[model samples]
Target chain A: MKTAQKNPPAHSVHSVHKTPTNPPDILAPVREMIQACIQCGTCTGSCPNAFAMDISPRGMWRMVIMGEDESITEELFNTKTFSLCSSCYTCTLRCPRGLPLTDAIQALKRIQTRHYPEKAKKNIHFYASFLESVRRHGRVRETEFMTLFFLSMKNPFLPFSFAPLAIRLMAKGKVKPGFPSAGNGALDPIFQKARELEASS
Target chain B: MKNFTHRYFYYPGCSLEGTAKEYDISTRSLMAALEIELTDIPDWNCCGASAAAAQGELLSLALPALNLAKAEAAAQASKSTAAWDILSPCSACYLNLKRAEAETARNPALRARVNAVLAEKDLQYKGGVQSRHLLDVLAKDIGASRVGHAVTNPLSGLQVAPYYGCQCLRPYAVFDDPEIPGTMNPLIRAAGAHVFPWNLSARCCGAAHMNTHPEVGISLVTDILKAAKGADLLVTVCPMCQINLEAYQNRASRLAEEDLHISVLYLPQLLGLAAGIAEEKLGLALNLAAEKDFRFETINEPI
Candidate 1:
């Protein structure tokens, strides 16, 4: 089940104007790499997420080669299959045409994140919030990252769903209730550096 | 051109400089005895691990490009008449460099932007250096035939998971298969250790995710540990993956409500053990596992 973001907008794949005539610089090499694909079904056939893909690896390759990037981009970013991609090189290793499929898809994700920085920003916020806890504490305190993630979300109780598990963890001595460590030097700079890097380009 | 025994350009990321000093230490000591020389990059910078990409996409590529540029310059300065093999002991560093090289090589425009960033430091990368992880260099350069001859101890009966992690194989299919990578397995076996064949061998240990999202990180580590439950030890080739899974294994195991206490050792450490290097000499003391628990004894029988 795909979970919708708090404030939703109704937009379909057709809304975006994606053309191949002159794609972004970051995307050109990707396009060329995808064009090298001979539409061999080997990737789709071997893909662990082939059944789950919005556009199968072959279809994604075809769309990329045709310069129908919006469709490809939408499928990748909006669909669960993208993240489900194991970043495994099974497809690339199997490609007889020597196309770098694994690298191309990951590169595609990086490209999409570049254009729609906000979505990437949101994911980063959720992701980095955890790192902030670790950097501040020397070691990661699960309770802290969970607390921050939930607080940032409109539905605060969403994280509580995992409370029972957390309880079990605490009982097993996997996580300590109190501060795991008493250091904060590396944490601030790590987070600050990450944020600054994100904000720059 | 000056000739040096087994000399290659080295790229050590932030972890080696700070947290994973043991990986840096052991790698240097083990490689030195094997005649593999590590020449660190001058003015080397971060490889932009999991942070750079999350912060912004451009820096993800640019940061690695900076390291690669330094390596290329060093290679040129050395004037060594060998292929430019830029060896990265860290998995994240290796992946980032390979990813940037593959991306820029594919897109000249992106290369231009990256070059613009490189211009700031007055360095230009000509795509000369081949970004290879230390594991690849061990297997490809020093073949199994050579490694077999070097083995002094065989880690027999010890079942180990050859955890490739994500960075070594992702983006660029440089060395091994991402899903079922066994590129390092044969190498381990050559040293006489039993390679534990498992599905999660190439699974993500959340890399930097453990630092950013503890829940996700814990969940990922739990799953990886669960998958690799049968193994005696989890041998890894990446520094970040090593730290996350090994350092955080107990915590992740506790979080998942299990009594999982799998040892995590570096591939080089395992190789060092097989190569007759003592466990203490290989920095096994720094490991979270019982250092004495997994030592391999040399066998008189041919493996």
Candidate 2:
């Protein structure tokens, strides 16, 4: 009888170091996380918005584990999955392998936001609006931020859907406009420094 | 009625000022009624919520670190005779501060980076502080028996489904089982209220997505309301969950094709009701669905 063929090492295929142009190092932080993914479809199954995502959590894992950074970012930039995450962390807790899926997704968001802002327009603009609000006043002014977000994301009508609730809130003496000058002196510089560090790093 | 007393440094995140004002009002009223003294950390800023972390890891760590630094300074300035635990009514603030504390402790490199950024503002984050959800404080620290004894106005008539949205129970929910949290159950029962159990208690309520993707958020909330089938109302810990569940009720009712008539109450608002605080003081009018479904009376508010 012929001897049975032995299985090769898991990383044997991806072991060769690719150049920086491939964005391999961009995902260096979650390299181990990607590899540890058993592809059990546990994450995809747990994700509430899996049906809406262009690339399911399972698909992201498969590509990332194989070091397919191009495909990963393409789907990330093209899809609204990360923004839909909500940081609920249900998948992280449910993962049998305990992969930090939430962090990995956030990492993907950070990379795309920093390097490819144009492609990641919807989510990136949302993040920018939030940061701008905080950076401007040391605290987020929700109405300002929401308005700016919708306008910047080119989805101004989005806020109109919830306008009735906003009206109710306004009537109830909630929805306080004009942010009090709380963190102006203390937090503005810190925010500027953070932006500087984020850009440099 | 028994007076359960404790001291906590309060961190009312930005949401308290705008969207979830009633949560803040109810938290204050409930804590005051419990004889729990709360010291607001002066010069507190945003916890960065979901936005900062998504932008940069350093920014995420740094933003909450600034709050911690401020909390530390306040505690030291007051020299208060209480354990310096920072109490955050906002689950997002609690999680962010807790995560900042953990990150600064574990990653020295990140801590150094954060401190360097903080140094510019004359702030420093020396990690050892504990960030606690007010619910955890009420349930674990104060104990259910005390809360039970303090219930002058038992919520016997009200059926409340305790909802633990992501922050207070996930990533690092130490008080109870993250999967099937029991912290709120005993407390809910302490107030003589019944719990409508369902798997979605610890599930995501499609949080900030209510703004970005309202459709998805509405659908998720519709599922929650569906799960909360026979309950009189859905009671929650996080502001975002409360707003999502409350604000989208009409839309959800239409979408689900079922007359989903349950109201959403902040846990504190429900507790305040049980404590006999006046409905106005508890800001009961602000809860959208609750205003529609239940009528509140000016209960016996003892001076």
Q: Which number leads on TM-score?
A: 2
Fnat, model by model in order, equals: 0.10, 0.73
Candidate 2 docking quality: incorrect, acceptable, medium or high: medium
lDDT of 1 by residue, A1-201 (tens): 245665344444423454556355445667877776777689888665465456787876766665544455454455444344544456776788878776676666566566755545545556455555555653345566666666666576566655654564454344456533445443344344434644664
Give the best candidate by lDDT. 2
Weakest 10 consecutive residues of candidate 2 chain B by summed lDDT? B294-303
What is each candidate's DockQ, to 2 decimals? 0.11, 0.52
Q: Candidate 1 lDDT, tens digit per residue, B206-298?
A: 654454346556677777888888788888887767766765555665687876667788887887888887766776766545345553232
In model 2, which runs have C-alpha deviations exceeding 4 angstroms?
A1-25, A69-76, A154-159, A177-185, B1-6, B292-303
RMSD per model, one decimal: 10.4, 4.7
- Compose the digit string of candidate 2's lDDT tens values, residues B1-303: 434334578999998888889989999998888777888877788888888887878888888999889888777777655558889988889999999998788989888899988998888988745788988898888878877877998988677788898888878857878888888888889888888767789888888777667778888988988998877888888888888887776677789897676667898888888888999898887777774435322221110
